[model samples]
Target: MSHPHPELTTPPPLPENGLRVVALGGLGEIGRNMTVLETKGRLLIVDCGVLFPEDHHPGVDLILPDFSYVQDRLDDVEAIVLTHGHEDHIGAVPYLLRLKGDIPLIGSTLTLALVEAKLKEHRIRPFTLAVREGQRERVGAFDLEFVAVNHSIPDALAVFVRTEAGTLLHTGDFKMDQLPLDGRITDLRAFARLGEEGVDLFLTDSTNADMPGFTTPELEIAPAIDKVFRHAQRRIIVACFSSHVHRVQQVLDAAAKAGRKVAFVGRSMIRNMGIAADLGYLHVPDGILVDIKRLGDLRDDELVLISTGSQGEPMAALSRMANGDHRINVGPGDTVLLASSLIPGNENAVYRVINGLMRLGAAVVHKGNAKVHVSGHASAGELLYCYNIVRPRNVMPVHGEWRHMFANAQLAIQTGVPERNVVLAEDGVVVDLVDGHASITGVVDCGYIYVDGTNIGGTDEALLKDRRILRDEGFITCIVVLDAATGKIASGPEITARGFVESEEIFQQVIPKVERAIEEAVANGVRDDQQLQQVIRRAVGSWVGGKIRRRPMIIPVVLQA
Candidate 1:
């Protein structure tokens, strides 16, 4: 299999009739999915999305795919074709639109609705085209065909792109859920037909390739959720991804069966579900749905609150409720069902929320203890079936971490795809299709662009390192006053610390070192305030590192008094 190499030079240039495929993100990770296709000097983008921050991200709100690769060529982009409505598939639409609004967005009905609603919040008006399964649209030099696919959400699609160079099929996140809740199964007949028509390159979702079997059908979750509703003695709280309309629908069905009224919590949950209901994707019984404000009027047993934060995002509703920070106090007699799989890197945060809820006398049920959730991506068995059916000339894995992609690549090879035809690449790796063959050509600048509050792409690694130090260690400041005429110490050398467990008296030991260091620097004719501050900083930093073994952020201030 071909792998990205550090030595690979910049791709020479797309051949006159060749198609260039480059992933800006989502090859080695589960989110921040974007891929750029170039043919005839025109660009076609598939899925602009965001990656949620983890512990290491500190103050970051979201991570975007660096758009620098396309900043100069935004006008060349014909349209961004969305495969689904999931956050990881469309969350970054608003940000990308901010760069150059008026770029047309193409997706299914619900997908377009969700993105338009989100874009409305950002005050961006986007031009959009809504297409359904089996529909075809010619945009620029690319002929796009949308095929129905079943996933956790409704109206998911796999795109078939035809260019002069070759035919490529990009399967956005999907599963072969034979009995999807919405009665839409992944269109394998279309895959077989496309295989007969010769798919030159196949880009597949690798998120579940490591799993050994087909993904469990979404229909199976209803029984488990019904059991939870039947056994709960008091109020029920179900936490899931806001965009998971099917799961929310399951919760509604369970609540209706149990004779309970449901209230949607969290702004995202309410907005997304509202859109789904209006679009006919989420069906709610007339009397079973109640406003969150009326939650107080109903008895505990007659209520169900569906909310966000199954991933344990700090600001999400379920997390706030778990930490006793939300108005909806979750305590005794409440059963909180985490109706979603724990995303990688979010285990600790999810566990912390679970522990807090349990400490407050609430019973917690998750995928570990209950069958409340199933993966949205197809597993190894399904991938093998897809490989056998599609039988594409070349295969590339997308939308997963390294291991998942590796596993998917192996599956493709096991199904008779030449080992040489499987391309295993990470984000930023460039692949080109020329003469009916796909190969890695080069790499590009694909870095994480951080979003903090209203700022976009403003925070870099250095800022994150400082934030980590402040959060994990502590902060210390040293103040020294100097005599302008003599270049000598004029007044006190004071040290103060915050976020440290050490007492103020403990810092007294380092104060002497700080004074001596400043005096020595001054005596040596280092009169520059910056130079003097550096000396003091080094002295105090060494003392703290040697004594306390902590590397907190150290600030040194020198003033001529």
Candidate 2:
């Protein structure tokens, strides 16, 4: 089944009089997320992110937001403010710098450190500015304050943008973690202060709006890992997100308490751990972290392995370990704990890893049987709590899918926000704030841009259409002979097929049928490269469809020479 692409509607020109918020991405998906705030011709972008893999796109590395709308308005973009160091929040920095060189990027120290590392990897440098809690800065006509918020990652912040139109709060992905691993909680007092100050519009994360209750704190998972580690007779391996430095720290501390030495395995996990430790964000005791190469020197019971690929990323250390391709392998009596949930579209890959691990006689624990992993975004109750605390006249749900946004909007209405004030925004929909009231003024051209290797290109309906065709139909190639003088078909048409045919006998039988069709077309005086190619293609398509009950992409190459 094919999903219809949303039509591109041009947003009503920015109101010359009020503040406007536009979400380019992260409104109805998990990645390639970005949001723009325009007040009096100045723009402040919040959380440039990249989307993870999807089902149809098997080998895609990352998907980024199409910045055509903002590309032309780069001068108007005062700053790109980040909320955290998660890939979805900071992954697009390299791409952004590739397009627009050295714009002022602002975030917390940890977040900025990660961004700097990412930029350095790309051989591009940017003007990075660190933002701390309560640090207010002015960019153009907008006065912004970064309020620290707790989540899976440390130093997460929610942006409070004060404009002439009104006060707007853009909550980057956050949760009400009263007992976060970092010991810093989401500031309820600050939220209440903003509410008291009369917030006009609230842009909040809707990633978990459909789920009920507040997300469990990161500290809660430590005990579970400790318990598993203490009782495990053999080695223990934990798979998690590399960017979750706080979670990694928890795992390390738990390993220490269990009297096990930990080893970082995956490339991303190793790189991030080095960064966090160097910056004093993560504290791994000396002699606790040994090189993976030196794992043989330690006892199995004393080894605690922390690696990446919880979502079953093929090349991730955990996945490779499960398949016995990794240098460090888990055998019988080993415990493999998946400390992260299987993100949507990654279930199959994750299950493959699980099956591989089970094949090696290892015990596996996940969200189903263990309290190892918890969401980083607020659930329905927490969403309502944030809504009540912000007390905004307008509530715009960002950073989730259509269902999540709809559920979040419902929560807003349930919390006394008017139904009309609850706006369901898509990629380019712009909501204008006028005199404390908000309305969808116009649409903008906002969509996804796929990054293939180093080439940046559009990921439009046409591209998806081709992908679907290739997936469903396979591919067909036809070679036909034509008279160069008259542009007429003269000889036979040969057909070739792959990824579709089952046996050599069946394919051979189909070839004669195709040749006969070409003969018939030539007898009918079919000529002209364009016309001959079309005739051969249509004939081959019909023949293949009738024989196999499938429509393959028919490529007819007519030779005039």
Candidate 3:
């Protein structure tokens, strides 16, 4: 059913007796997965995560769900249930914990370990309860059952939450990889079992809902990776997301088979793999792995290097290596295997890193040349199979942008789910289920809260607009020493620029024009600080656009002397 617009819809007084589902993020976005499930004054948050900043969110370290709703009702929240360890699923744990310290975090073992490590980074030691597949845990007014789900990381789980209102199944970021590297496939049998139990609502990941085919099994990539290890006569480096334990497993297996020692580079790659190996999720045969400092001890053909930054992040290990700034460098005989999916929007950066590596005489093998990377989210076929198996009366597609959500809704409709039962949700839409009936009731004030270093929130549109302007056209600041009583210029209306195209000579030529504009604003009796600033801003803006064909941010300062 249609939901009220968030701007118009105030939180419909939490129903007297119904389960209200609201996504603070991850419905209309690709990452930062957070969903709030509420009933009888008790609230449960599923997968508090973060989204990486793109070209648009310049200078933002991470994008998190505005947790004001939960923060406002901290007493109502029972626990935080995490499905996996991926950043998008657990990145905002510290932020959430900071708001309210006592909320218990419940997830699978690997998931808890990663989250614990993150919390430790923030010096936060919150209550963490680790649950396993098939085990049930009761938190507040809900019971949660973790179902084994195969994904990029180990110990990923799909949570089947039971409330007094109904049983809602949330399939966290998952793929039904039949031959997963870890031999732990998604528990479709469990889904079928849950379906038989009568699930009221099924919220599935829609990241790849538009893709037509099933995701290729994770096992398929190891053969190609092994072949690379077998054929490479020089040092071989594989770049991928550090959290891909399965890929790291394959790399370890390949290194062992090829009689080469593996060195983990990059802080994230080392820390995450160490945690995985310690947790028994990653199996590194004795003598097959070596310290990073010892990478130079082995000859080219005797070493296998695994690093992060498959997305071409600037400071990531692979990017640094490409620019010769990394401790480990590759040359003529080396091979750099980019064993990761090129996330959309990362094509440009990834290709730039590839070009740089090629310029360094290193041959790069990636998804383009080989099936080294497969998607971690369910494709259309997998979604259909899940829909048919789960057989929930209501379908709410989560974890995708708007297009993906609509496509997933269409798929749900095609799979015999009533069009009326399929809810197309954005970030703040609340899907309410009562006595096995579902409808989008109202909305919440939820949006993105940017994380910049130690700073949180207040990263508004105006600041972002200023950043964009500064990045694209640079900035021009005019300093005016003014008469205190009269508000008239005392000395100079000087201009300074950082990134604009105006040279010293051009600026000198335009100085008179700028002064005339200011003089005219003054002669016209523009005395109010705001009015004066706007007058100068518009005048300079017009001159810049007309003369230089540029649109720079104009900062006009008026001082009283």
Best by TM-score: 1
Error of 1 at 156 (Å): 0.2
Best-to-worst ranking by lDDT: 1, 3, 2
Cα error, residue 368 of model 2, in Å, equals 1.4
- Against the true structure, candidate 3 reaches a TM-score of 0.95
Which pairs of residues collide in model 2? Answer: 10-443, 11-442, 11-443, 12-442, 31-51, 32-50, 32-51
| Tens digit per residue, CA lDDT, model 2, 270-324 | 8888988988889887779898889899999999988899999877888888888
- Model 2, TM vs. native: 0.94
Which has the better TM-score: candidate 1, or candidate 2?
1
Specify the highest-lDDT model's number. Answer: 1
Candidate 1 — what's its lDDT? 0.93
Off by over 4 Å in 1: none
Once fitted onto the true fold, the runs of candidate 2 whose alpha carbons sit more than 4 angstroms away are 1-9, 458-472, 483-492, 523-525
Q: Tens digits of per-residue lDDT for model 1 on 1-561?
A: 999988987787899979999999898888999999999999999999999999999999999998998999999999999999988889999999988999999999999999999999999988999999999999989999999999889999999999988999999999999988889999999999999999999999999999998899898888899999989989999999999999998898888888899999999999999999998999998889898888889899999999999999999999999889998999898999999997788999999999999999999999999999999999999999999999999999999999999999999999999998999988888999899889999888889999999899889999999999999999998888888999878877888899988798999998888888877887787899999888987998899999999999998888997
Count of backbone collisions in candidate 3: 0
**Candidate 3: tens digits of C-alpha lDDT, residues 85-121:** 9988899989999887889999988889888988898
By summed lDDT, the worst window of 10 consecutive residues in model 2 runs over 1-10
Q: Order the candidates by TM-score, highest first — what do you get?
A: 1, 3, 2
The C-alpha TM-scores of every prediction are 0.99, 0.94, 0.95
